[model samples]
Target: MTTLAGKTVVVTGVSKGIGAAVAAAMVAAGARVIGHYGRDRAGAETAVAGAADGQATLISADFHDMAAVDAFWDDCRAAAGGRIDTLVNNAGIMRQTGGIPDPIEDWDAVWSETMTVNVHAPARLLRHAVRDWLDAGKGGSIIGIGSWAATRGTSNPRAIAYAASKAAITAATKTVARNYADRGILAYVIAPGVVRTQMSVDSAEAVGGEAAVTAGLPMGEWVPPEDIGALCAFLAEGRARHLTGSTIDLNGAAYIR
Candidate 1:
């Protein structure tokens, strides 16, 4: 069985969705987790409550706000206790008015918000993780939570900003993977589509419903968060570390490229 026993992993956006599932899965696999959340204290606490004994810690930060984002890394550094084995960049946002197709000021604000939280925040956190790994002289991995939209544009033009932000960050992740592999820092991207999370369900509803979302896919079902969580656990083990710059698409056969 794959295991991360005695390792320390940082998973952001653990208040819910795939982030929460990853945190729980890593803790279950015997790794200590620092689960980051935005505002949901109870949800954050709940995400790690089932962790093995005391293997999880909940950290809070609003990725939308730069000040809080910076301070969060400070606190995460302290929580690392000098060594960090892995980091899962999972926190992201997609406003209903996310794109700037409309030249209006309101659409511009939405576009900015999506990029700030989805791309810029993760970049800041990645810098800190890379620095720590370099300082400790230990090999570690980074798991970036991307989306299928990063590779294939979404049907909803309103989410163009969200798609663009993810694509940019995924490319950055690949670059880091290639450039830093010799330095023992690895990066990988998992781009998923139509995940069975609250956000996905809400988005499906906005368009039609669960059935509408599933019917569009060949599998006729949504990819569960636990599946992504399990995949993350496997990659975090470093067994397939050579696949650092690869992008694993988990779209339930909705989009193949």
Candidate 2:
């Protein structure tokens, strides 16, 4: 039982999927959440809805726009009353895009966009949180929502960029954990396999079918998004602080590296 009473957290991509689940779990754990979304206010609203403590606030932002990212952070700071204790960098985009044999321009566009939102956006938020925590003389946690691709490369050539981006964050997260552990700044990466999200369903369908994807996993089923959320809450607890800079795998025994 992780208790986060009075703690404030900012969760990205809360419009749906894992982000939404994470927000709900955080609220259940008694943490205030500043949920970020783009064009899905209804989804974000539901994510923060029914909180036991009434601490979930929704903010909108487009990751494609860097200025929007900055503005979103400003809004989060205000909403959180400058007391952000944890950042769940959960917002991400997985593109079933141009493959190795695709046109050069097609590959370039997908690669660039994937890197921008998946890597650059989260990296920016992590930097901001670190700076603010340093100035306030407080310790904080950064949870990176990476993928199993960050470790075992994906078979989908179309998602090459996605795997590469996740890999980048995994390494960057380890670096942050090494450098800031002394400062009580903990960083971790939750690398999950096929989660039960629309995005994962689509990706599975692209390969063949859900059954095919499931049979590949040792668990023979897709992972629930809340599992990641539960881990987020667990990691946020004081007891798990010593596991900083670790990459927690949630792939259901698919790849045991």
Candidate 3:
């Protein structure tokens, strides 16, 4: 029975998958949500449609573009009525064709795209959120969506860049928690092993197949995105401030460490 009533949460990548689920969960907790979608307006709309009017607002931004990332923060603040209680960094990209065996140029392109969308974009957004909270002298919460690939290397050789980007962001998230906890600003990382998102399914296909991936998992099923959504909502409540700087893993015991 976590309550986020009267809170404002900003969730990026609200178009689909974990982002959409997080937005829905936040709305369900009675928090006003400022949701960011890359390009899928319809998906974004569907995610928050369950909320009462004025409970959610959707903004579109291409995270690959730094300017858009900046604009997104401005727009998100405006949508939240100038105050955001929580920031959820959920948008990310995993290039499925960037292994060392690939052509040099292709590898470079994949790494660049993956890092820009996954690491750089979230870093920029974190900066904006932290600075704004400092200026307002109010505490805020950060929920960074990370991956198990960050801790245990991904089996998919093509996703080396993806793993690297996630690890980088995880470190950055911990840094934030260490530096800002005394100010009441809390930061956490959610490292999911293999959620049932399309992204994971696609990655499975690239490695071997869905069957192979599932067999390797301790649980016979993929981690549901709803679980992630629920955890995001719980963290947004800021109930467990001591959990700040912790990386909560939701891999169904597949890659526990």
Candidate 4:
């Protein structure tokens, strides 16, 4: 079992889905988690419950707003008493629009919203964390939640913007690892194919249906959110520092390189 004892971790979008699971997993691993939730306070509370040593705190911030992202980072650091050991950039969006056939107005709106929520917001927080880590001379870890769609183009053309945003972040994460490895900074990407989340369910409906999507997977089942959470916790431990800069696929061999 991985233990994050005495570590302070920050997880964005902790209200539900992958973010919630990551937060819960880290807490159970004995890390003090500072979770960010957009609107669902109750859900965030539930996710952090039963934390090892009961040291979990929740903050609220709308990812679409750049200024709010900065505030969230500052507040998270304050809650962690000016030290954050790990940051899990797990908040994102996949709009059902932005396809080639979409109306111009709809396409533009979907692309804008998806980029803001999925890329800009998380990147902003990462920037802040990296700067703080450098200033303190205490290197940290970053675990970005990317998707297999980032490398393997999505079959649903409507998700073009979503895939693009994920690719951008994945590149940024690898760049960080490359530049900061000597300084003790670690970064990794968890690229899941079809996670069992409401987002995946919606995407499945857009392509065909959940049954069809599942049948096409080699494992014949969607990846569980808990599995991703476990991976996040292990990465957060930063035990295998040599694994930094790697994008670990959690898609059950659906899109292997």
lDDT (10s digit) by residue, model 4, range 189-244: 99999999999999999888999999999999999999999999998988889999
lDDT, model 2: 0.88
lDDT of 2 by residue, 1-257 (tens): 78998899999999899999999899889998899998999999898886855588888899988888888999999998888899999988888876798898989999999988998888888888998988988899999999998788887777889899999877887888999888889999999988999988877766788888888888878899999999998887757888998899898888777
Models ranked on lDDT = 3, 4, 2, 1
RMSD of candidate 3 to the true fold? 0.7
* Candidate 1 lDDT over residue span 76-101, tens digit each: 77877867889999999877764445
* Regions of candidate 2 where Cα sits further than 4 Å from its true position: 52-54
Question: Residue 10 deviation, candidate 3, in Å?
Answer: 0.4
> Which scores better on TM-score, 2 or 4?
4
**What TM-score does model 2 achieve against the real structure?**
0.97
- In model 4, where do residues sit more than 4 Å from their true spots? 52-54
> Model 1 compared with the native: what TM-score?
0.95
Candidate 4 or 2, higher lDDT? 4
> What value does the lDDT take at residue 108 in candidate 4?
94
Question: lDDT tens digits, residues 1-257, model 3?
Answer: 97899999999999899999999999999999999998899999999988998999999999889999999898988887899999999999887897999999999899989989999999999999999999999999999999999989999888899999999999999999999999999999999988988899889998789999999888799999989999999999988999999999999999877
lDDT of 3 at 136: 95
Residue 54 lDDT, candidate 3, scale 0-100? 90
The ten-residue window of minimal lDDT in model 1 covers: 97-106
